[model samples]
Target: AQTVTQSQPEMSVQEAETVTLSCTYDTSENNYYLFWYKQPPSRQMILVIRQEAYKQQNATENRFSVNFQKAAKSFSLKISDSQLGDTAMYFCAFMKTFMESSGDKLTFGTGTRLAVRP
Candidate 1:
């Protein structure tokens, strides 16, 4: 069984500042993909970043990056130069690497509601 945990229920960051959201997970599978998804008021969840368990380098996007500590089973998101558009509920998710006949499903954390203020 695999599980994702987000300790903080809510977080706040000022515009132009940076914020790091914490996430932890438990999984026995060696090959997997970790992701951070953001859901705004519209309820559409958007992919923020993704990290592969076997990859040593962390994944990053324009303003989003992940600090993946595979040994510790930790994957956290760092948002740089936060903006109001970044305000959303962020979820941590995990999915095992696809196999021909595998029935793996995504396991998600409770989520952290982030507010970017002016």
Candidate 2:
């Protein structure tokens, strides 16, 4: 079974500052996918970024980036130039590769609530 662990339960960052949230996982599969999702007060799960296990380079989107350590089974997210609107509950998810004929479901971590203070 694959499981994600978030050490921080809550984090606060000043507006315009940068923050990194920690996440680590345990998986025996060699091929899989990792994802970071953000859920604002609206309760909608939004994909922040994704990384393929086979990719050595980390993935970045705008001000968001990831530090992916495959051997260590660690994947962390870095948010730069943060804003109040960025405040949300961030979740780390893992998904196994599914066959073309099969369906897949996402497994999520407990989540870390981020507060961007103005």
The candidate that wins on TM-score is 2
Which portions of model 1 miss their true places by more than 4 Å?
none
Q: Which pairs of residues have clashing backbones in candidate 2?
A: none
> How many clashing residue pairs, candidate 2?
0
| TM-score (C-alpha) between model 2 and the true structure | 0.97
Task: Estimate, for each residue in 1-118, the C-alpha lDDT of model 1 and write its tens digit.
Answer: 9999999999999999999999999988999999999999999999888898889999999999999999899999999999999999999999999789876788999999999999
> Candidate 2's residue-wise lDDT over 5-114, tens digit each?
99999999999999999999998899899999999999999999999999899999999999999999999999999999999999999988867999678889999999
Alpha-carbon shift of residue 51 in model 2 (angstroms)? 0.4
Candidate models: Cα lDDT each = 0.95, 0.95
